[model samples]
Target: MTYCVGMMLDRGLVLMSDTRTNSGVDNISTFRKMYHWELPGERIITIMTAGNLATTQAVISQLEERNKAPSERHNSLLEAPTMFKVASIVGNLLQDIIEERATDNGQKAAAGTFSASMIVAGQIKGMEPRLFLIYPEGNFIEASFDTPFFQIGETKYGRPILIRGYERDMSFESAIKLMTVSFDSTLKANLSVGLPLDLLVIERDHFTPRHERRIEASDPYFAAVSTSWSEALRNALDGLPDYRMDPAVKEILG
Candidate 1:
């Protein structure tokens, strides 16, 4: 129903997510899947979610509420000592919400229904930029040089490009371009994933976002990227060696 990606690069991190939710072919809506919290020079955290809209929204709401409470019994995003801790907190919250919803309804919630997964990326003042893929079970895995990116929800259509082109030390510009291309591939193959993408870039050790953008359907850069990528793919496919067989061999096989 949605697609979100977070890439960990040597220079920084890049995150992007689509903004579409649908109950059926006739019922469709747009809702942002990206959320960010910033403490200026101290910390910056961004979360991109994919799954049941209600469940994700509730988790985010509860986190925000806890952060604002006078006697915070737990570490909110702002209070987390490290990026790993922040991810653990988010994963736990997501798991709790899913369990509560499933218990109240007495049904096994389908994947991406009462269940959700998130990509958490950011930095605290003393730590390096980190990226995590938080699963529905309250456990997560961080990106490493071997696996420098994480994607969730409707991901299969977009994963090939990342697999072929991703580099751990790529520049910020190249990373965003690769991400845009990945999103473009998904958009072409799936109707459930739609436009108005949210993109955020954080340079290493900045403790703040370097770039944040919303790419609407009419955005020129997005349009150009999509068109160019399509053309390039077509050209590449055309250049691949074609299969040929001798007429006698073909007839014998037939």
Candidate 2:
């Protein structure tokens, strides 16, 4: 399992994903799940994946290969005229890979044993930045005014934080802080999601990443954020109005 989040903000876009993958408690490993392709000044595309590692890897590898081929192919993400088209290409590729794998294994695609999902976020020159959540079925939904964020993989544990804290116009600093809290919440709840997270911040119109870094277990800022969030949660719970026992129920128990 893993966790990846892509948040759309007025500033640009913020993306983060954990590197942990495990087959069992005894067999754990780390693998990068975030990838991006940029055509400086023209466009920038970033994808964060979760689910069957092989399926996601294959899809990414094929996209990379297309990127390296001639620009005339028009099959490359770089040559796609808009972010929508880029997303279509990625979604189709992801769906095809999952179906192929399932067929090779003599299993039904609906079995979902070989499924994967992705969050594709970035901007094309002359357009407002966009964010999408692509599912295993080759279908996707874009982030908009009502939905300005996407989270994939081990999502439930961290979803509440995002729901309560995300804002469409928040600064990048605030977005990063919010993401850390979300990721930290998941890390505490699930052993499958661990440290060494990859983070990328793309500023509007830059067509390139404004900030990119990997937050290892030892990263100071993440450490501080994790500790602070825990304390905040405890304090918030304690500060909330206490639950009072019903008098009749209490008397019966007594």
Candidate 3:
């Protein structure tokens, strides 16, 4: 299992993903789940995947191969005219890979098994930055004002922080802090999602990544963020109004 998040903000977009895959407790391994394609001032695309490692890797490899080929189908990421089209290409490729693999193995493909989901975010020249969550069925939905972020894998533990703190117009610094809090929540609850996290920030209309960093286990900044967030949460919880039962209710309970 893994955890990946893509947040849409007025400043641009923020993406993060963990780098761990395991079939069993004893069969753990490390593999990057984030992939990016850049065309300098023309376009920039980042994809973070979660699901079967083999399936996701195959989909990415195929997309890269198509970009290298001389095909005219506009299947290449570089050839995509809009961020939406780029997401469509990726979603279709992922669906096809899962289907082909399932057929080869003589098993029926279902949404829960071979299917993989991805978060695609970036911008093309002359377009605004966009973020999408592509499902395993070759379908996707874009992030909007009402829902400004998307998360995959072990999402439950991390969702509350985003729900309470996210803003579409937040500064990049605040967005990163909120995302770090979300990630810390998931890391504490799910052992399957381990670190060495990949984080990418794309500025609006830049058509290129503004910042990218890898947060390892010993990163000082992440460490401080984690510590501070936990303390803040503890303090907030301590300050909540205490339960006070009415006299009649208390007497009944006694």
Ranking by lDDT: 2, 1, 3
Q: List TM-scores for all candidates, in order.
A: 0.90, 0.91, 0.91
> In candidate 2, which residue ranges exceed 4 Å CA deviation?
66-75, 244-254
Instruction: List residue ranges in candidate 3 displaced over 4 A.
Output: 66-75, 109-111, 246-254
Q: Which 10-residue span in candidate 1 carries the lowest summed lDDT?
A: 66-75
Q: Judging by lDDT against the true structure, name the best candidate.
A: 2
Q: Write the per-residue lDDT of candidate 1 for residues 1-254, one digit (tens) a residue.
A: 99999998999889999999998878999999999998989999999999888999988888888556656544389888889999999999999999888878875655435999999999888778899999999999998888989999999999999999998888899999999999999999999999999999999888778999999999999999988987898899999965557887666666
Colliding pairs, model 2: none
**Each candidate: RMSD:** 3.5, 3.6, 3.3
* Candidate 2 per-residue lDDT over residues 55-80, each given as its tens digit: 99999888877556565344378888
Which lDDT values do the candidates have, in the order given?
Answer: 0.90, 0.91, 0.88
Off by over 4 Å in 1: 66-75, 107-112, 247-254
TM-score attained by model 1: 0.90
